[model samples]
Target chain A: MRVHELETPAVLIDLDVMERNLARMAEYCRRHGLALRPHTKTHKIPELAHRQMASGASGITVAKLGEAEVMIQAGLTDVLIAYPIVGREKAARLAALAERASLTVALDSEEAVRDISRSAQERGVRLGLLVELDIGFRRCGVQRPDEAVALARLIHDLPNVDFRGVMFYPGHFMAPEPERRQLLEDANTRLRRFYDAFERAGLSIGVVSGGSTPTAFISHEFLGVTEIRPGMYIFNDRTMVGLGVARPEDCALSILVTVVSTSVSGRAIVDGGSKTFSTDRYRAGDGRGFGLVCEDPEAEVEALSEEHGHLDISRSSRRYRVGERLRIIPNHVCTVMNLHDEVYGIRGDQVEAVWRVAARGRVR
Target chain B: MRVHELETPAVLIDLDVMERNLARMAEYCRRHGLALRPHTKTHKIPELAHRQMASGASGITVAKLGEAEVMIQAGLTDVLIAYPIVGREKAARLAALAERASLTVALDSEEAVRDISRSAQERGVRLGLLVELDIGFRRCGVQRPDEAVALARLIHDLPNVDFRGVMFYPGHFMAPEPERRQLLEDANTRLRRFYDAFERAGLSIGVVSGGSTPTAFISHEFLGVTEIRPGMYIFNDRTMVGLGVARPEDCALSILVTVVSTSVSGRAIVDGGSKTFSTDRYRAGDGRGFGLVCEDPEAEVEALSEEHGHLDISRSSRRYRVGERLRIIPNHVCTVMNLHDEVYGIRGDQVEAVWRVAARGRVR
Candidate 1:
């Protein structure tokens, strides 16, 4: 099937562009002697994960155990769950999954470590544990280097878990070009202190995994980091473009939508809305609207309801009529991919393959 | 199964609360002598639609044709798609759905009318058409009454399409109590003019359908409105409470999430994030965080990542520990329902039933 032949509100991935993104990131990692473990939370497809692995990814990183289970089922044995796992039910599930695949989990609290230790002991499997240090993103992770060493020491003494190094997400430092480079350098300086604290505590750090799409290319500045995990680099998004990590042309995924209504002047409604493109905003405070229209660069998606994307076409000279199809580059491709069940991989106009979003809705 | 037995990050519908909400709305419509056509976009479950139909709904309203198809498969014969659908693929699918159900579509343009007419003609079925008028909400509707009449006339003269009355969504008039009454009255005055103009054109208005959740109870204030279609009344959210349409106790749906991390001093992280609760902000601008934490009202969900909801518990007296479960009332229940695949209907602490979100991801 061709791109024009498909239905509206469908997710389209330019395979050529995606392959180029994959190769570029892989080569950059190889040049820096950094192990690449691309996060699968962006595409959530087994085919894409396999491609990343074939291109030179040592392992795949998932946000939850549900996503890791899906990847394990697809024969991707090495997996790293980058979120803190709590609750007895989830720990048990993770321990069971670890028996089948080489599993690693990030932890910040001792309670979570004890819970996972018990689950792994019951399942008779050893799980790799990474102490999550707060490099700046205050969402999760240990706040201080002392806390990181404490957690690492606790994990090392645990019966069924191995203390692997530390991991941090510098998501708070998303800026464009030179500013981003400086932000990364500052974050790396703090992270190196945390790594040295672990060494001073007589702990040998094996994997210092830390890197987001905004700072993926400049990850080498973080001297002690051994691996980098960048999720959105596979698809990219308006956020990456705003942060100067990627150009608009480097975005591989887009939503193919049709102009459904054009009754109101200066505005046109597209078939794709919050349910299709998602409500992810550019975190860099760029205020570039919800998504960008690829055909008319001037057209801005001012607002989005559940099923109607309100497009502001006042600045554009071209008039859009009903039934006209438009491709939109979403603000964040990760959330958009999670919203759809399947995505079409297109080469030029022809759809090369249809891949199911394998781990979509795997929030657990 | 019991509520406690269910995993974390689950969508739970309080069956007793849901039944009371359904009854209250049905009784409101009954007292007003208006036909009840409850929009099914809130729950998107076949069982819930059946319950609404049993409560005295004349029909069900869906946002997309894919939803109508799901309703039709569940033996629902009456459905109105309350959006302007374009493209040949959708029109053909809509026509096929019309053959199985009493299908009606909302249209603001002549091109959509012609497209549906051709599809209905090809399928040898007559589809009902409603001219959507922009009374106040300037979304997907004709701005002027003459444009509505023109579209209605076109539908009236079409090959296999019948011109129904008209439909309008007063979404912008969402306010609380006495102020909301004034807003509805003002919107009704403008809508009355459009209805009168359609009558002046010799078009007999059979079904003047309009009413959102915020203005559902006082729908009779709009003199000529014969029916009301409100989706969110079934599962009221923080937005509805801020608009004074429903109180917090009246909300039926709440996400059951477990606290995964509490390393931060004033903050705790839940298992549900944007992927589970969605990124819909409070529409009434109440400044309340993403969703209200039910157990501790003072605790606010300050921010959300893809799989983690950060909660600020400094103001709350209750202390949350890891693995502790909390119920959250989302800002918008419609979008949250779309995010999950299934919802558990519970009575008190017991799970009554598990209903699949039948029309989930039906963006087409």
Candidate 2:
């Protein structure tokens, strides 16, 4: 099928651009002597994960065990769940996956560690553990260095769990250009304190994993970081462009939508809305609307309802008639991918392949 | 399975509360002498739609053709797609659905009518058309009464399409108490002008359909309205409560999540985030947090990442530890339902049944 022949509000991925993005990230990691562990939460497609591994990614990172299970079932042997897993059900599932794969998980609480340890022991499998450090994003991770060391010690003392290393995320460092460089430096300075604390306690931190798309290129500035796990690098979005991480043309993913309604004076409605493009705003507050209109740059997506994307075309030089097709580079590609069932891999005007978003809605 | 035994970040619907909500709306429509066409976009479950139809609903309304197809496949013979659908793919699909079901579509453009007319002619099926009027939503629909009459005439002259009536959505009338009443009155006054124009043009408006959850009860005050299409009445949310339409206790849908991390100082993280509960905020901007914490009302969900819901527990008397379960009444239940795959129907503490969100991710 051709790109224009697909139905409206369909997710389209430029295969050439996506391959270039994968190769660029892999080459960057090789040059920096770092292991690339691309996060699978971005696309949630096992085919994409296999492509990443073929392009030289050491392993893959997942946000949940549900996503990890999908990747593992697709024969991706090395997996890292970068979130805290609690409760008996999740712990048992994680331990079961470890029996046939190199499974590792991150945690910050002793209760979670104990549950995982028991599950691993019952399954007679060894599991790797990484103590999560709160580098700046206050959403998760242990705040104090002492607390992280305590959790590391607890993991070492467990029956089947080993203290692998530590992990941190600098989600607040998404700034433009030189300013972002300074923010990454500041975040790295704070991360070094925890690294030193763990070293002073005679703990061997073999794997110091941390990296987001915003700081993917400059990750080497963070001392003691051995690996990078950037998800959105595969399909950069408007947020990434606004943060100076990627150029507008480098954005590989876009929603192919049509102008469904143009009766309103200044606004036109597209078929894609919050359900397809999502309501996740840009972090920099760039005020670049919901996304960038590839066909008409001046047209802005002012707001979105459940199934309607309101495009403000008052400033555009060209007028869009009803039924005309347009492509939109969403503000955040990860959430947009999660909302769709299948995505078309396109090269130029033709669709190369169709891949199911196998792990979509796997939020468990 | 018991409620406690279910997985975290799960959507749970209280059967008793849901039944009560359905009964109240059905009785209201009966007393007002209006047909109730409940919108299935709220729950997107066939079982729930069957319950509504059994409770005296005339039919069901959907936002997309994909949803209409799902309902038709489940044996629903009557469905109205309340959106402007363009493109050849959608027109063909809509015509095909019209063959098996009493399908009606709302549109405001001549091009759309011609496309649907051609598809209906190709399939040898008659489609019911509604001239969509912009009742101040500014999202879609014709702007003026003359424009609506022109489209109605076009529909009347089409090959296999019949001009059924007019449709309007008072989306901008969401407010609290006396203010909401006044807004609804102001909107109705505008709607009366359009109805008068259509009547003067010798067009028989068989079905004047309009209603939103915020103004569902007061829809009878609008003189020309013959039917009400309320979607959120099935599963009310914080937005409905803020609009003074439904009380907090009236919300039937709630997300059951477990506290995954409490190591952070004044906050704790839950297993659900934008992926589970969605990024839709409260419309009133009442600073009510993402959703109301049912167990600890004082606990505010200050921030949300992709996989973590950060709860501010400074004002709460209760201290939430890791693995502690809590229920959250989402700000918008419709979008929340679209995010999950399955919802549990619960009676008290026991799970009565588990129903798949049959029409979820149907954003074509």
Candidate 3:
């Protein structure tokens, strides 16, 4: 079947573009002597993670135990749960997963470490632990270098736990050109401080995982970083485009939507909305609209209800009639992918595959 | 199983609270002599929709044909797809669905009307259509009253199409009391003009559907509105609380999340984030956070990444530790419900049932 023949509000993945993106990222990481463990939170597909592994990814990184379970069940032997795992049930589940695969977890708090350690010891399984450092992204990880060393020391003492290394997410480094470069420099300085602290503590940091799509290509600049866990690089989005990291042509995924209503003047409504494309705005740009209209670049999706994409066609010279199909590259691809149950993989106009987003909505 | 024993980042629906919400709305519509066609987009479960039907609902309202199909398959005889049905394939699907159930589609454009009319005629199915009017919310409706009459006339002329009066979404009338009163007055004036235009056109307007959660109770204030379609009243969120339409105690759905990280000084991280709770801010409030922390009402979900809910617990006098469970009422319940696959129906602390969000992600 053709891509256009598919249902409206369908997610389409350009196979050629996606393959190129994966190959490019894999090659970049290989050249930099960095292990590529592309985050599976973006696509949430086990097959795509397998493809990433086939493209020379060392392992796969996931944000939740549910996602890791999906990947492990799909024959993946090595996996990393990048988020902190707390609670007795989750820790027990993590230990159970560790029994099946070579599992690693990155966490900040000593409480989480102890929780997981107790579960792993009870299950008689060894799990790799990466002390998460709060280099800049203030969401997770420890603040000071001493805190990181303390966590590492605690992990080293914990039974059934291996102190692998440190991991930090430079999410704040997604600024544009010159500003991004400066942010990278500051991030590297912070990395050096953590490395110096680790060395002074007589700790051998085996793996230093840190990278986002904005800083993926410059992973070498981090000096001591060993692995890159960029998720969005596999399927580029408008945020990556706005950050000058990926071109519009590099965006592999697009929502095929049909114009449902053009009754309101200067605005047309599409079948896709927040429930389809999500409410994630283009933060890397002017922070205005929800997506980039591929049909008419000037047409802006100004607002969205649950199932109505309010397209501002005032700027576009082209006229949109109801039932007309249009493709939109959403601002954030990760959230958009998570919203759907399945996605179509297309080669040009032909639908080659329909892959169920097996790991989507696995927030547990 | 207990609700607490369930996994973190799980969607929990207080069944008692939901039943009370359903009963209240039913009684309100019964007293007001309005047809209560509650929108099922909030819960998206076939059973919940059936429960709404059991609660004296005239019919059920859905935003997409996929949702209509789900409801119809679940033995609903009357379902109103309160959204535009565009494209040949979708129209064919709509026609096919009409063969099994009484389906009414609401659209603003003549192109959509003609498109669906062609399919319905070919399939020997007479489909009902409501000419959507822009009462105040400028999303997907005709601006002028004359345009609505014109669309009605066109629908009347079209083969296999029944003109079922008019419909409008009063989404803009969700302000606080004083401002909301003014907006409602403006909306009523606009609705009156549409009614006058329909009367002058010699149109027997059978149905006048209008209402959102905010404007649902005041639906009788609109002179010609005969049906109310409020979705969020089933699972009230922080938005409804902020709008003073529903209190925090009235919210039926709350996400069960685990506090994962507390390393950051005034902030804590929960397992639920934009992918779980969504990026929709609390528009009815000060619009600072993504959700209301039910544990400490003063604590706010300041920001969200894909898998991390950043909680600002500075104002709360409580200190959060790792493994602590928190329940969050999201800003928008509809979008939050769309992100999850299933919801646990609980009675107090006991899990009574597990419901699959059957109609979720059916944007087509």
Q: Which candidate comes out best when scored by DockQ? A: 3
Q: What ranges in model 3 sit over 4 Å off?
A: none
Rank list by DockQ: 3, 2, 1
Tens-digit lDDT track for model 1 on A1-364?
A: 8899998889999988899999999999999999999999999999999999999999999999889999999999999999999978889999999879999999889989999999999989999999988776677888888888888888988899999888888877665576766777777787878878987998989998988888888788877889999999998988888777789889999999999899888899998889997887766555659988999988989999889999999999988999999998999999999899999999999999999998999887
Q: List the residue pairs that clash in candidate 3.
A: none
Candidate 2 residue B195 Cα shift, in angstroms, is 2.0
Q: Is candidate 1 or candidate 2 better by DockQ?
A: 2
Question: Against the true structure, what is every candidate's RMSD?
Answer: 1.5, 1.3, 1.5
DockQ of 2: 0.85
**DockQ per candidate:** 0.80, 0.85, 0.87
Off by over 4 Å in 2: A176-182, B177-179
TM-score of 3: 0.98
Q: How close is candidate 1 to the true structure, as a TM-score?
A: 0.98
Pick by lDDT: 1 or 2, better one: 2
lDDT of 3 by residue, B160-243 (tens): 999988888988877788998888788878888888888899999999898888988988998788999999999899889998
Candidate 3 chain A least-lDDT 10 residues: A179-188
Quote each prediction's TM-score: 0.98, 0.98, 0.98
Report every candidate's CA lDDT.
0.89, 0.90, 0.90
